[model samples]
Target: MHQLLSRTFKPTFLKIYNESHLHNQKLGRETHFRVVIVSHEFNTISPVKRERLVHKSLEHELQAGVHALSVIARAVDEPLDTHTSPPCQKPVV
Candidate 1:
């Protein structure tokens, strides 16, 4: 996933967190993710457009059972938010 996003975005800074453990799904499943992407490509784009671009780039993964994705896309000049996803309320089995 990280490689794919890197190829697609060419971001200056990128972080991909696999939050699958925070879910109740089967162990080792790569279902949930949070990605922070900083790239010049996003400079003049609207927030919705940035998200759409990221989503479009990961279309294949989403189809292959990526259940949830949280994205924070920013231009190179924008401030980054490093926070990750909230803890899951559901108990892991």
Candidate 2:
């Protein structure tokens, strides 16, 4: 999958997380993953298009062992602020 994404998108920041451990039941193969891809290629593309590109790139992997995939694709210039938020303070009772 990493190879496919590298070849297809040439991402600046590509993080592939193997999340198969979260799944209790096995689904044929142990290939559940989460991909966080940051690239200039996605700057001009729509969200759906970005997902399609990923899916197209991993077509072979999808057929082979991969089952579930969660994709978080963004342009290289885009900051990952969404993943980090200010801590919430507890209210006094």
Candidate 3:
């Protein structure tokens, strides 16, 4: 997925997180992921389009393994405030 995004979006700041552990209690493949991508390509695009672009880039992964993806796409020049959120607790089965 990172490779696909790198080739297609050429992001300025890209962070791909494997959040599969969060869904460990669920019955399915461990394919959940979260992507935080900052790129110049997103400057003129809408949020929906940004997601579409990412989906398009990872078409194969979506078909093969990835079950859920949460994306945070931003423009290269955008100012993003950093904040630390609370850690996630393990899900009870």
Candidate 4:
């Protein structure tokens, strides 16, 4: 997942949190993630567009069993936030 985002965004700062454990998935599965990506590529883009770009870049992984992706996309000039993913509310089916 990191590799995919890196390739597409060329981010100056990137943090990926494997939050699958927060959800009711198999113990070791890499199914959910929170990605904080800071890149010059995001300059002038709206927040929604930045997220769409991240989603577009991860299309393959999304189709291949990545259950959820929470993206925090930022322009290089923007201040970083102490953002974290919220715990999953949906229970195991």
lDDT order of candidates, top first: 4, 1, 3, 2
lDDT of 2 by residue, 49-88 (tens): 9988888788888898777777888987777532422233
Worst 10 residues of 4 by lDDT: 82-91
In order, candidate lDDTs are 0.90, 0.77, 0.79, 0.91
Query: Model 1 over residues 1-93: C-alpha lDDT tens digits?
Result: 789889988999999888898887777889999989999999999989999999999999999999999999999988887886788896559
Stretches off by above 4 angstroms in model 4 are: 90-93
Off by over 4 Å in 2: 25-29, 81-93
Q: What is the alpha-carbon lDDT of model 2 when measured against the actual structure?
A: 0.77
Query: Which residue pairs in candidate 3 have backbone atoms (N, alpha carbon, C) closer than 3 angstroms, thus clashing?
Result: none
TM-score of each: 0.89, 0.77, 0.78, 0.91
After superposing candidate 3, which stretches have Cα over 4 Å from the reference? 25-29, 81-93
Q: How close is candidate 3 to the true structure, as a TM-score?
A: 0.78
lDDT digits (tens) for residues 1-93 of candidate 4: 789889888999999988999988889999999999999999999989999999999999999999899999999999989487777798659
What tens-digit string does per-residue lDDT give for candidate 3 at 1-93?
778899899988888877776665365446888888999999999979998889888889989988887788888787754333334577679
**Which prediction has more favorable TM-score, 1 or 2?**
1
Which candidate has the top score in lDDT?
A: 4
